[model samples]
Target chain A: MTVPVPFLLGAAALTLSTAMQSPARAQSAPAPQIALSCAGCHGVGGAGEGSVPRIAGYDRQAFVDNWSAFRANARPATIMNRIARGYTDAEVAQLATYFASLR
Target chain B: MTRLTRRAFGLSAASAGLAFAAPATLSAQTQARLVIIGGGFGGASAARYARIAFPNVAVTLIEPKTSFVTCPYGNLLLAGERTLPQITHSYDGLKARGVNVVHDWADGIDATAKTVRLRGRATVAYDKLILSPGIAIRWNAIEGYTEAAAEALPHAWIPGAGEQTTLLRRQLEALPDGGVVGFAIPPNPFRCPPGPYERISLVASYLKRHKPRAKILALDAKDAFSKQGLFQDAWNELYPGLIEWVPLNKDGKVTRVDAQAKIFETELGTRHRVDVGNVIPPQSAAKIAIDAGLTNETGWVPVNPRTFEATRARDIHVIGDANVGQVMPKSGYIANSTSKVAVAAAVAALEGRPAPEPTVYFNTCYSHVGPEYGISVVGVFRPSENGFVETPNSGGVSPRGPLAEQREQRRLEALHADAWYGAITRDAFS
Candidate 1:
């Protein structure tokens, strides 16, 4: 599904055409909006909590690599494997950047 | 910088809105009005999130009760593990955060006029309306059971620190040591899918401690239920020979109740006499939703999965237990999670911006079978062409086994359940 480029960071870089790009193509969609839902389990701003890990300010490449591995079934996990498959590689990159930008 | 306080997060969200200035089509308004009904998990979450995400929006939450007692950990109360005040939360926090917390019953909604008529107050107008009115019990669904009967044979399904919960707990306490406690479990699509089973487990926990020889007979309408395996596993290990679950095929569907006689008659003409009866009848969306013509044939409101906008109504969003067509369960966590999405979408629509795409929804239901014994089911969903689809392999019930690690995890999950109650209520009310 296509998500309009979110009006986060700034709208200066966006146009009507750029905003209409599918989520797969719009690799820079603001991460904070998507990351807000994660706060329930992963803690506020992905800062982590008891038993649940903190993803805020993680190495972007490492975050992408781990999610990719989970998506590809190369990693064993209880819930992350399934969640990883829900996002495209580009969306994952955006999420990694968003989390890394948190701290 | 390392740890973001809620105040800091709220500031960041407000700044994000100011930085972008929304879309060009948005009205040049200093304030927009957003009204939410039902002050429970869903409505409260929407009010709280809407206030933070769009600081300028005038958010009003209409609820008849000043405080809400959650159903999530209510079973623990029956087991005597927690007090009512612990599960109850006041709306002062939401009020302090700039949400107009109106303590009134939202009686009617005029979709065309964009106004909600309250029971004893003036009608409140809104630019956007969110209805999370939860579920209404179908009184006649089970013969011989009505509102009055609930006083004696309590359903205890609805959230609140009310007489129903207290009645059920008192009955359990008054039951004899070797007496039978019977439950007439409702069918599919009811609120808190695994609630009856959890109640059974907790009641058994109380019985084992106070009335060691007491037994529980669960008569279910459906052949299976959520986290059935995990519940059964824990029951076997925790309270063996104390609980018996009868499925529909086994004539477990209750047809009528003799509330005075304390007897439940099943569909197959079998009658079971018990010391206490817990009859959970079928359910439908709250009456207000039906009155507003928002619910479909199934007595549930169909909505655009991405926006939670009522399919048949304009400018009104129906969420929580009242909404259908989503693969997610009608659960507290789902209601809380979906409310945020609904609020965000409503804000975007009110601002004339396209709603966020690829909306991700999450639900984690934790059921405590006994002290330090819990099981859970987790799911992540994204909207599809038809409705919301659970992302494959992303969610499942707690792993089942006799392994020590699995047992430890169950114990930890019980602790997490307590923590989750604290966190979610804070997220919504505080």
Candidate 2:
């Protein structure tokens, strides 16, 4: 069981690394430079300010996982909930990973 | 400085005309030659997507400036929360994504030749032309204000490489402790619905901190604003003495601006003088759209809502603020979403595939009442047999109750506004 746990953890790490390196499948291209606009209010580290929560510290997989939920009306807010609906599944993930890396 | 002579102007015009006449002959049809006119949200998105969806496509986006400073977050900058550089974007990312980015003004489009002429001696032909040239300031609409006179009293409307945003910012900063700021809000069907209101709130926030006694007098052309009730409550609670809401009928209509005297005249012959003036004048589709025979009497391009292809021009599509799109605000989100549908329709037409039907779209306008508190409206839309219609009773405006948590939620959303701006710009240009 101990041996299996080590192997499983190593595989998970490999998977995470691969996902981060690969270009988002939905985008068909690398993400552009405009992502910097998010850094100010959201924090360069994603440690959000005032009412904005800590998106930077969110789990990478969880961040990617929540985007579809955000887009499909599962999540609701004055802005984010509506904004989340705009991106493709891949954009959600790309953004998710970028912010999660700051964590 | 070089003076504009008749002979020089004529030569420049003739050369530009010839540039439009030149035809671009690519080897393959699948290898599309795409020329996008504007560098705003629509044009930038089209250029980015064209490179991806059709890798073989030769994508060329033409704009006069190398950098694109967005009007979306410019209000925050005016509020002193953000800087000009924070909202600015460069074309380098688009160029890196396999796009031919050209820093030249689009003079005119030769539909017959399928080419666009530049102001200089250059032309680019295209298999499919996407024009998202944004809006133009309607100078003649206001009585005493012209393009030149706007220097003293800045509109700060246009996005990039100009004095508009910076000029307005400096004026706001320079204003006396108890001075008044007059915002001449434009009529409906403008670029950003919540924009003028947001501007008012932002300036009010600045006054609340620095001047405290300064006031924001909003002279709107419309009876109601984007998020009127929510904004009014926020203003009263946050900065009671700092902001004043005046509707069009309540002696708020601005007839003209005397820049020298800093006086704004109303319809009823009332003159209100202000120290800092930020007048968002009436607007129309950019001059490029009108010149291409795409505009109707409204000075905006009428397009098939299903495909965003121009009704008046063949093989040309117009999106963004320049195109007349009902059921969607001319917000960046809608423009970005509409561009996707337009791209898919164009690709399907080119590939002989059935264009997707019932294209659903959405728009969310987030306006910050202060730093942390924000309010917004979310509208979902789908193409109906008649036209694009909002999903009936599907989404509602921001909550009315003055709960502390709700205001905090508004603040979180405002922060998300910056996040989303980053994401959308990345999606479009990066």
* True-structure RMSD, every candidate: 7.4, 12.3
List per-prediction Cα lDDT, in the order shown: 0.80, 0.71
Error of 1 at B339 (Å): 1.1
lDDT of 2 by residue, B89-191 (tens): 8999899987888999899998877789999978887766888999999995878878876888899888667479888999989999888998888788888
Q: Indicate the residue-level lDDT of B404 in model 2.
A: 68
> Which pairs in model 2 have colliding backbones?
A32-B430, B372-B411, B374-B410
| Residue B327 displacement (Å), model 2 | 2.5
Question: Candidate 1: misplaced stretches above 4 Å?
Answer: A1-31, A47-54, A58-62, A65-87, B1-30, B403-405
* DockQ of every candidate: 0.15, 0.06
**Can you write out model 2's per-residue Cα lDDT over A10-102, one digit (the tens) per residue?**
233223333444254333233222233343335433556444567765787887767666656676645555546555556456667666555
